[model samples]
Target: MRDEIKGIRPPSNPAAIKDALDDIARIRGRPLVYPFIGSGRGRGALVELADGSVKWDWITSIGTHFFGHGDPEMTRAVLTVASADVPIQGHLQPNGEYVEFLRAVSSIAPGRCKHVWPSMSGTMANENALKIIRQRHAPAFRVLAFENAFAGRSALMSEISGSAANKKGQPDMGQAHPVPFYDPADASSVDRTVAAMDDAFKKHPGEFCAMHVELVQGEGGFRDAPREFFQAVFERCRRERVAVWVDEIQTFGRIGEYFMLTRLGLEEWADVVTIGKMLCGSAVLFSSEYNPDPGLVSGTFAGYTAGLALGAHVIRRLRADGLIGLQGKIRALERAVSERLQVWKSDRLIRDYTAVGAMAAFTPIEPDLDSIRSMVRKIFDAGVCVYYTGHGPYRIRVLLPGGCMSTDELKEGFDIMERCL
Candidate 1:
């Protein structure tokens, strides 16, 4: 660690970064601590913190770095764009790169979402998507998201989320509603939940504009709605001409397919779809209807030229590499681990174990923020990188990227996690 720091050009003060974070906390009126100290080397799926610790990366820039940082091709693409981007920033500069990238992303979009409204972050992209719902259709078009489904942190997203913290200062849409999500493990629980959603539809009737969802619900503790239930939801939405939105911000790409609905066959049933985190690799994506009105939804920095170039290049590479065909490799890895590890026995504190694609999480045998943080901190210190999606006291989540972590690396991380518990 000392050598790495000493070699850095002119040296960067570690304290300065911490000081800036503290300043931001004060400015935002929040006390959130900086979770991970990014090395910024943008190399391998690993982190070497200032304290001389090594870690395997499950948080690939929150999975945006699916190919891991320092990818030669991605690096080359970034360089290629940086040189040409000076021209993309000009006023009213419409270029083919931006349009081509949009075409590639729309080609992969689920259902009827052939057009996209790109944004700087997933939060704003979602906020824009909501406007499309309210503006195009009647203001009475209700926005419905499943309870515990977190879309983003914007005010409108907060209004859709069930958390009081997010909703506290956020304004609300009078026509929005939330339904209880379904869980299949509890037998009748899924049917009962769907029954509740069915009832909700009756209450709202023709007021619904779109039904937003994160198929796997990664933020809500890696909980996936029952496949049957999802099919039912899609059917219901189609029957009523209500938009079915699959929030692929977290679940997209990680599951082999671009969206979970593709894996579950809901793409044919969906209406509006939103995707972010690896659309053009770093650029966020929110799409609905092939082409909204020119001024229907626009952002100052949305769909910047540089990001468009990267997106176009990435889509070509993904298609050429047969990435979709590699999904079986993801499922095979999960089966191999589940079968190979005897230590993964169920316990009273173990709420569940979910592994799909490169995304996986194991609920703990008695979870808490301290316990979760301690486990993750220890993992970083011990050299296996992972994340903690806090969901009560019964989850020790591990979010791995589909193409990021190799099978051997994933097994090693799991082994370390077993010891951590």
Candidate 2:
């Protein structure tokens, strides 16, 4: 461990933490599973809790904190924007920070996705992307998405997402057309998906506007598919004249590329893309061909000024520090995690492991939801913070701090997980 985070220890004031959690539960009308509250101080991947305990924060707020906590560059970026006239930039009037953020995102975005629109969250970015695509392909309101894909939780997005639980009790929008996602374990996964696509298109000809894909499904259990799988899917979309929308909200930056499409050699297939999480602010990047008409997609708040500054800074810093590319820090950490997971799999401690760059997940020996929940709680109590994904047979997910966490620290986290297991 680094000298700064060497003081990590178990909680010394459980009573105080319980009291705070009680207050939180009262205010939110529900209780948190882990009862976590940050002390507003941390170093790299290690964060201190309000109750005087420190834990390895491997999830990084569901892949938002790319550089982890208390990063000097990130801190400097925030301080630089702290003196801005307005805290939040808006569509009607945006500051230079917004322009700079756009420039930064555009500089690293796929060449075809030239136009950029910044938003406050990934869901809003997806909403904008949806509006743009739907406007371009009017009368074709249905969207094609993969099964087990998670778009977001907005009313429209809930309809579009593959999760039935998310859309429960809500009026059906009847706009989503889900096909099976790629299954690496199945030899005919690609062919099956292609067949399903053909079936959907044949059944509802000229009714689909776009196909939304997560190159690496984050909330859907950190699963990934081979490039060939995406190539086949995108080819079918192209043949049907349906727009291809890549949702890189959780995979951006953490993946060993600025854009996952660029890394997979499928950049040309992307007509529109939505990015968020690690960017600090969310954005919709689209081709000129898919740009929406005037007054179609506008929001009141663009984003916080500091977040925009940090987003730009993160882009530049990632490039400057050589944290991207095939042989970069991100892939290095991914390799380390994969190696450990492989060993555990061999030992039958884990059933299977899936990963793409820093986003990873592994099914525990006891894969039931209740067992997985118990294991996660134990892991948290043992000084590591991780989350689970998927339904039924759950898998523990980890979003490593690729920019700030060292291999040694990652191994330490694995050790904690093993102890919990």
Segments of candidate 1 deviating more than 4 angstroms = 1-35, 50-52, 85-92, 171-173, 280-291, 326-328, 336-343, 346-349
lDDT of 2 at 305: 97
- Measured on C-alpha atoms, candidate 1 has an lDDT of 0.64
User: Against the unseen true structure, what C-alpha lDDT does each candidate score?
Assistant: 0.64, 0.88
Encode model 2's per-residue lDDT on 200-225: one tens digit a residue: 99999999999999998877777788
Model 1 lDDT at residue 363: 66
Candidate 2 lDDT (Cα, whole model)? 0.88
What's the TM-score of each model vs. the native?
A: 0.85, 0.96
Model 2, position 28, has a per-residue lDDT of 93
The ten-residue window of minimal lDDT in model 2 covers: 1-10
Candidate 2 Cα outliers beyond 4 Å, as residue runs: 1-16
After TM-score superposition, the amount by which residue 179's alpha carbon in candidate 2 deviates from its true location, in angstroms, is 0.5
Clashing pairs in 2: none
